[model samples]
Target: MPMRLTKLLGIELPITQAPMAGVQGHALTVAVSNAGGLGSLPCAMLSADALRNELTAISRQ
Candidate 1:
């Protein structure tokens, strides 16, 4: 059967990494995204500038 999550998220794998604030960043998110899984950026503990920078970094990958 087709995975609902994969179809909904447009990813090959139906895996989602939990957003771990203060423990993870864009690198981990990019890695998961590259591997065809849903990756989350933990924004709760980040400042606006930090979030923007992380977003920029993720986009660059």
Candidate 2:
């Protein structure tokens, strides 16, 4: 059967990285994305400017 999760998430693999607040940042998210898995960014603890910066960094990768 086709991998439904991969199809739904638009990722090459079915793997998904859980958002790790304080332990992970945009770099890790980008790395997982580049590796063809679904990566998560934890924004619950971030300020608006910090979130914007993280997004910008992720977009640059």
Candidate 3:
């Protein structure tokens, strides 16, 4: 396949998993990243502390 945004993001594919807060699971991001797609996480709606925690979790994985 041709290069796409996913490749720009350092992934192997051009498909990204849509992130939905309170709906889609955070694990979805890791899964999509593993699959070469850009994994996304919805944290814009979270508070500063919550966002920090979420980022820490991501960093750990």
RMSD of 3: 1.9
Model 2: per-residue lDDT, tens digit, 21-53?
999999999999999999899999999999999
In model 1, state the lDDT of residue 30.
100
Clashing pairs in 2: none
In terms of lDDT, model 3 sits at 0.78
lDDT of 1 at 59: 95
Tell me each candidate's TM-score.
Answer: 0.92, 0.93, 0.77
Off by over 4 Å in 1: none
Q: Write the per-residue lDDT of candidate 1 for residues 1-61, one digit (tens) a residue.
A: 4588789889999888999999999999999999999999999899999999999999999
CA-only RMSD, every prediction: 1.2, 1.2, 1.9
Score candidate 1 by lDDT: 0.94
Pairs of residues clashing in candidate 1: none
Report the backbone clash tally of model 1: 0
